[model samples]
Target: MSTPAPEDCGYPSPRPRLSVEELPAAENTQPIRSLEDLAAGTFESDQELEEFLAFTCAERRRDVA
Candidate 1:
């Protein structure tokens, strides 16, 4: 079974869209927010990366529920 739409729809008619210049400026978009620099460090052992490759899939995925 199916139903048919009326000849007139979409709340009778739609209003004209506002131009960009006429639109109000958003507060969040005003200024660029600064982000803190991330802390980075080298591995304790140069071979650490190579050793990690030997770890099982379970070991690679930490804090599993």
Candidate 2:
């Protein structure tokens, strides 16, 4: 039997194209001074800290990409 095409193999289709304006705004850039400042309670809550980390990771990915 013939193999099914990539789409017909049950994988989800690619995401819809989005215009630059339609995309989410980039995160605010922060200047990290030291490891102590990073470890300190700069963020108010756990959620805020998580968001900061996620933003940092996204920025790094974009830079590497």
Candidate 3:
């Protein structure tokens, strides 16, 4: 079996990829202070926990960049 090319896979390729230098800087971005806050067990429900995890992932990604 052969793998399909990006175009043959039936999804549109992202157009005009921008380099890091081409992207504009965000003025108000803030670093997350603590992952410990997510582990504090204060969430009342599973949905809250999922949202917090998602937020943590985004924060970590921003911090790395």
Candidate 4:
């Protein structure tokens, strides 16, 4: 399936930019063990969402300075 544009993601603005540091702090990250956890009304906050997106988008990109 094709990935939807950021605008289609339902943000107030289209293609919003997010800072890497703006992602949720690792200490506060929650464990997503199962789909049931998501269906149970968890996964709060946009920061967590951004973190997950970043992980998916940059997973193969090495951390180069």
Which candidate leads the pack in TM-score? 2
Clashing pairs in 4: none
lDDT of 1 by residue, 10-58 (tens): 4444555766755545322333344433324445765885676656555
Q: Estimate TM-scores for all models.
A: 0.21, 0.39, 0.36, 0.27
Tens digits of per-residue lDDT for model 3 on 5-43? Answer: 788888887677666655544334444678874576788
Model 4: ten consecutive residues of lowest lDDT: 18-27
Q: Work out how many backbone clashes candidate 3 has.
A: 0
Candidate 4 regions off by >4 Å?
A: 1-42, 60-65
Greater-lDDT candidate between 1 and 3:
3
Ranking by TM-score: 2, 3, 4, 1
Question: Residue-wise lDDT of candidate 2 within 1-65, one digit each (tens)?
Answer: 99877689789878778666655544444567788767866779999989999999999999998
TM-score winner between 1 and 2, please give it. 2
Alpha-carbon lDDT, every model: 0.52, 0.78, 0.77, 0.68
Order the candidates by lDDT, highest first — what do you get? 2, 3, 4, 1
Per-residue lDDT for 1-65 in model 4, tens only? 99877668986554445566655453466668888777854458888888888897787575552
Poorest lDDT segment (10 consecutive residues) of candidate 3? 22-31
RMSD of 2: 13.5
